[model samples]
Target: MAEQGKAAEGRIRIGIGGWTFPPWRGRFYPAGLAQAKELAYAAGQLTAIEINGTYYGSQKPESFQRWHDETPDGFVFTLKGPRFTTNRRVLAEAGPSIERFVTGGITRLGAKLGPINWQFMPTKSFEPEDFAAFLSLLPRDCDGITLRHAVEVRHPSFACPEFVALARRHGVAVITAGDSPYPQIADPTAPFAYLRIMGTTEMAGGYDAAAIARWAARARDLAEGRVPEDLACAGVPQPPGPPRDVFLFVIGGFKEANPAAARALIAACA
Candidate 1:
């Protein structure tokens, strides 16, 4: 399916953070042969997709199939485990539900599945001892398949060095994220790297080509060879402004920054 993906020079993956549209069936869009063609059209520019919506609930197989068929090959799909499993506040004890959610998400996507993002909420105080132990229990096999795993921790404790050590030990990627409230994840060394960029960040979220260029410059530096070793921990930063082709994930949220980011990415990549 990726065979049809238009190859653009200075290409960089650009996409929205998660599904926000209510309608799924092919009503809003035409190009997408599946549920949401508009989303698909947006996804066309992105080489990878981080499905944050799935983290909230389970998606039907039909929905998953539709998404898989609409996209081209070489496209990476990063899914977030349900919040019940990921959010360690009241739902931390919900182990059975967690397993079910993870299994369902992974199985539904099948080959399209990439890393399952386990993003923790900011409420829970970071407790590495319990947290790390719980994370260790994640089955290496999901629905009889082994997949890449990445964790995005919101608690401050996650920023410490110990968290990095634990993430590296496991085959999970240490997500690099830039946010407005606080910068949670960092650029660490691992087999895989998960990155998150907020379009609202005062420091990074401006519709300025210079800002996008700066972010792209950083991404190009990190994307250099030796990605496998860094995959576990290494990931490029998110390009500023609208979703751009300069970085792996040019996330454009509800902001004018999306197009701005896109412009900057095009310039830097050019």
Candidate 2:
């Protein structure tokens, strides 16, 4: 009940991309931990996880239920929207794909389900009308569960104020991608903030202590509805609102050190 109360009031969640990395075995995972216990172990350590496999293919309903049963209460899973839905010529024509993916029994995760990230190719340019149409296709609810959507646009074309305005108009969060070549958009457009931080291999725990401290501060600012002045904002500044939930994933950098980074961030936030 305490966990549910914290979740309801909005809290910061730090986690890694996925739990199935071979490198994590004997490093993040115990030396002789069974493969079947990986998810449970990861869940115990991290507050959330971004499931990258769903971006490639669909999973059975039992898989979702199993994931929910394996994890503790308040653990969240964010899924990547399928490539078939986002890697298309016409964004507006992706209704069927979106519907299929959303209705594919993901509700089995119940309260454990978090945001659904729709990542676009770097080559995909921003088309305001088409993009707005695509945002409209994202349903507000699925099987009585409220759904939150976040967009990960990698192209430089999406760095414009118009794009931010469009996302804000539809109440979809723009992902803040760190330590990558992708254009980072830090505008807070929704009720929550989503960040994917990729730290370097040179630093221990995927990030130096100073960097982790900075990220912790930034996460707290976002969680409290105060945008950090250090980050770039493409849209005009808006007044701070009520505190919002934050989901931060340590991904794409030193893969082996991601768990350590996430743990460090969690400690810093604490």
The prediction achieving the highest lDDT against the true structure is 2
State the lDDT at 159 in candidate 2.
92
Per-residue alpha-carbon lDDT of candidate 1 for residues 95-123, written as tens digits (9 for 90 to 100) = 68667866664566666666677777776
TM-score of each: 0.72, 0.96
Prediction 1 TM-score vs. true = 0.72
Score each candidate by Cα lDDT: 0.55, 0.91
In candidate 1, stretches whose alpha carbon ends up further than 4 angstroms from where it belongs are 1-12, 19-35, 90-94, 200-206, 225-253, 256-270
Cα deviation of 222, candidate 1, in Å: 2.4
Q: How far is candidate 1 from the true structure (C-alpha RMSD, Å)?
A: 7.1
Score candidate 2 by TM-score against the native.
0.96
lDDT value, candidate 2, whole model: 0.91
As a whole number from 0 to 100, the lDDT of residue 231 in candidate 2 is 85
